[model samples]
Target: MAQSIYLGLMSGTSFDGVDGVAVQFVPGQPLQVLAASARSFEPALREALFALQTPGHNEIEREAQIANQLAHDYALTTNELLQQAALKPSQVQALGVHGQTIRHQPTLGYTRQINNPARLAELTSIDVVADFRSRDIAAGGQGAPLVCAFHAVQFGAPDETRVICNIGGISNITILAAEETTGGFDCGPGNALLDYWANLHLGTPYDTNGCFALSGKVNENLLHTLLAGHYFALPPPKSTGRELFNSAWLNIRLEKFDTLPPQDVQATLTALTAHSIARAIAQFASRCQAIYVCGGGARNPALMQMLGAALSTAGLAHATLSTTDTLGVPAQQVEACAFAWLAMRCVTRAPGNLPSVTGAAGPRVLGALYPR
Candidate 1:
């Protein structure tokens, strides 16, 4: 039997690194994750990318250089995947590379993922699929939480309603109900603010195991203020990123409570993620019997514990809380695997965005290809 192989690369809102997976998709069969690899961005490149997240002088040239750097890093990870899988580039159908997102404003009718796909193709000698969001935005959709479609196919169960919560820099959810339409939307800030506070105070890229959060008490007033943001009240078919939840946004809010301990703020931010997600599920997916978490936040025991408590407080105590590993996909790899599945759909000229989740005008074939 022939193998339908594709590679997916993702550098999500966390700006931590690139995660790549080489997967085989057999129709009516479980996906075979042949190999997985991740590479942290060089400190300089990571800082440059983070700086690009906001407006700056001489932005155009800076962005170009960073994009090229990202492509080189992506190629390095691609090489690692090929080595691990022992498969030539020609054997893979395409590379679904979600370039780092510097801006995602679906309301503005444009979203930018900085990447030089042509360079990636040149370096790897493989067909590359990039820009998977703009088409949906053109169709009047959120152009995000695109993983919901993949989640449905990869994790849905016939006997139960399941919710897949991906907690990257921004948290999002996908609802899979038996015989019901799959739906999802971004809940709110995930690890973005948590990581920012950790880096700012603890001198770490992230709060390992959420020990910092667990060490402090959540400031209820701070949590209340964080939840009062307009984004949380807005209905679904929506998405957000650093654009609305960056350091400036947090610092401004923090101005009101300088006396609060940094660890306390971190604890509140963690709760903010949990409570907002719980609210989304309670209001939108209250019927979901299982909540499977994936992404960096899943590894945070403190955040996980808070999420479970929040759900219970939201009247979903019966719902189970666990990571996607129970479903055979590691928590951190779900988004990367999703892009791989999307690349397969793109190469086959099939629709990849779900109108139910992204609220597109209709199904659209996502991604632009740069053929090797």
Candidate 2:
């Protein structure tokens, strides 16, 4: 039998880097993550991406240039993963690439996740499937938090409910109940504010293990003020990104506290993530027996502790805290692995989006294919 391998590439909202994974799927067997590799976007590339996120003059040309640069970087990451797995490109069936999402406005009827799938296909010598969100939006859905299907596939348990909380640039959650429809949505900022505040104060991309936040005390006043926003109260079947929860949003909130401690603000942001997520889980998955966190947040011991405490505070003391690693997939690898599985679904012409999760008109096969 042939090796059923596929490649998945993801550069989340953090604008940090690209995560690549080569996975092997076998019928009636466990998922085989053959290899995984990551590469940070160049500083210049990161700056360009951040700039292009909003709007500017001459953006058309600059956006194209940046897209080209991204293709080059993505190609490098893909080749590295292939090398790590000691496999050739021809052996891999297809590559699923979640390009950099510069603007995500589902309400406005469009969301742009930029990537040159044609170029990626040419460079990698493999079939490519990208642009997976537009169809869902056209079908009147949020076209986001697309991992719920993957969460159901990978984490669903027959006896107990499971929640997959992925804290990336923005945090999202997936509920897996054996008898109910799987669903998820973006809760709010995850590492976005934490990373921004850290870079502002420490000149680092992110606070290492949330150390800076751990050193500070949570300011209840700021926490309450931040929590007062209607975003959290609007309920699920919703999604968000840097567009609403970026530095500008933070500055507007910070304006009221003229003399607040910077580290305290970071602590409050972390608390906000914890509280909002805990609240969502409590409301949506009250019967959940386990909460498995993934993505970059899993690496932050301080944030994890806060999340556990918040869950206990929400009367979910019976719930256990764990990472996706405990279930045979590493935290960082889950998203990439999800894309790989999604690509497999695409080629198989199987529906990928879950209507209960995205609120789309109905199930549809996501992503456009770029043949090799």
Candidate 3:
């Protein structure tokens, strides 16, 4: 039998760019990437997205336009990938479109991502699989950390424990235990809070390789205050995002400190992310034998060093996905690749959600299919 091909598209919280990956999955073999492409969100669109993250005046109309614009942008991205690979829409099985997430309030039983998959299919003439979160949320789950199944397929080994830590706009970890154990959940803020601080204080989109953070000193008191949030104490199967850790959240913490250097603030924010992520791994994923870091945060050297230092302090060894010599798949493309895998699963009528990861009542098939 021939392998099936699917395209996955993702615009994560980092708002850095859109990643699209073409994946071929053989029925009984590991998934392989055929081609991949990424295009940064244009400045205007990115600004609009960032604006929506806060309490804005044009919330309703802006959100509706964002949905339409995202679908159009997704179609353009898919078309570019197809053109580059010399593949026609009919040649692929489906496109997994993880629309740009504007709000992911899964606790309310709905997560709003701003892409119309049906419109994407209509424009691109490809079957689209989207809105993968609702099913899990409906089944009494967090509807996040959905990549656990994908992590299992890619990193799960028969004899060794593995941890897949994704440091996207929001960080999450999937623990693939030797045979008896398998679970995952959002660790804490990934690039969200750091990016928020950078944009506010430095007037830049991000710190760019942790340069700003490296120049500053860590504020222990601010770090302690940031860590005191209720979300940090929440047990596994819980998830959070900009909604909880946005500018307002940061201001509340800043109010406690009379004054501080901007770089120091950056340093403390960086520490918050690294420390919270490390703490989660220690508390929930201590048994895992290896930790593989991915997502945008993987690119920040200072954050990685802090994470390594924390792991060492906890008496745990750490390594990144690059260390395993698996950089064939770009860190940015992993989430997008997972969506492609999810599309294939939907087509095969397979369950994509891991009950252990999402705290779901049971295994559930995910995603809504939109026919071309």
Candidate 1 overall lDDT versus native: 0.94
- In candidate 2 the C-alpha lDDT for residue 33 amounts to 95
RMSD of 3: 1.8
- Please list the residue runs of candidate 1 whose C-alpha ends up more than 4 Å from where it truly belongs after superposition: none
Q: Where does model 2 exceed 4 Å of error?
A: 1-3
lDDT of model 3 at position 303: 89
Q: Score each candidate by Cα lDDT.
A: 0.94, 0.91, 0.84
Put down candidate 3 lDDT per residue, 170-200, tens digits, no spaces.
9998888876657889978899888888887
- Candidates in order, TM-scores: namely 0.98, 0.98, 0.95
Ranking the candidates on TM-score from highest down gives: 1, 2, 3
lDDT of 1 by residue, 1-372 (tens): 346999999999999999999999998987879999989988898899888888899999999999999999999999999999999998999999999999998998999999999999999999999999999999999999899999999999999999999999999999999999999999999999999999999999999999999999999998898999999999988999999998988898889999998899989999999999999999999888999999999999999999999999999999999999999999978999999999999999899999999999999999999999
Error of 1 at 179 (Å): 0.9
